[model samples]
Target: MSNLKQELKENIIELLNLEEFSVEDINDNDALFGDGLGLDSIDALELMVMLDKDYGIKLTDPKEGKEIFQSIAVLAEYIEKNRTK
Candidate 1:
């Protein structure tokens, strides 16, 4: 895996407190929300905070976040496109 993919996986696991998943358990295209990982709205909010904290991207609108955070693949693409740092 490239550094970006690895970093994203590690960050997601750490930021979301996914204690049951090691780095390898998190596939690059894993569904991070809804039925896949069982993450809920609150987890999405936490992940938004993580984006702001770690990537310098602030998602002020929760609705906007819904489109951006559909899954790990989508989230990574959004971050890659929007992250300031």
Candidate 2:
């Protein structure tokens, strides 16, 4: 799980093109949107693609992404459980 979390941070930085953020800049529990990382809906769509392309996890419902993407920890957990790649 910890390893997954670290991978998630790295993936997020790369996938989101967050040049200003390093893996250390993201906390396990930090919110990824709004007042946290300040990501918008477009970022969310990018993340959905990241999940599918990298993890082989497909989220058909955007609403499901809300809970899974609340933080790196949660996202990592979800991926660890569901990732096919």
Candidate 3:
């Protein structure tokens, strides 16, 4: 779980081009979308693709992602359980 959160921090920094944040800046419970990081629906789509490409967890329905991606904790748990790789 820690490793997944760490990786998420790295990926978010890179993927979002967040030039100001370090991995330590992100809290595990911090919301990845909305006011927390200012991410939107498009960002969610990008993240969904990222999860599919990097983790091999294809999210066929975006609605399913809502619960699975509420926060980094949930995302990591979902990935750990469903990841093909």
Q: What shift in Å separates residue 11 of candidate 3 from its native position after superposition? A: 0.8
Q: Give the Cα error of residue 76 in candidate 3, in Å.
A: 0.6
Which pairs of residues collide in candidate 2? none
Count of backbone collisions in candidate 2: 0
Clashes of 1: 0
TM-score of model 1 vs. true structure? 0.85
Show where candidate 3 strays beyond 4 Å. none
lDDT of 1: 0.81
Identify the leading candidate in terms of TM-score: 2
- Model 3, CA-based lDDT: 0.84
Cα-based lDDT for every prediction:
0.81, 0.91, 0.84
For residues 27-79, could you state the per-residue lDDT of candidate 1 as single tens digits? 77767777677788888988888889998999999889988877667777888
Sort by lDDT, best first: what order?
A: 2, 3, 1
TM accuracy, model 3:
0.90
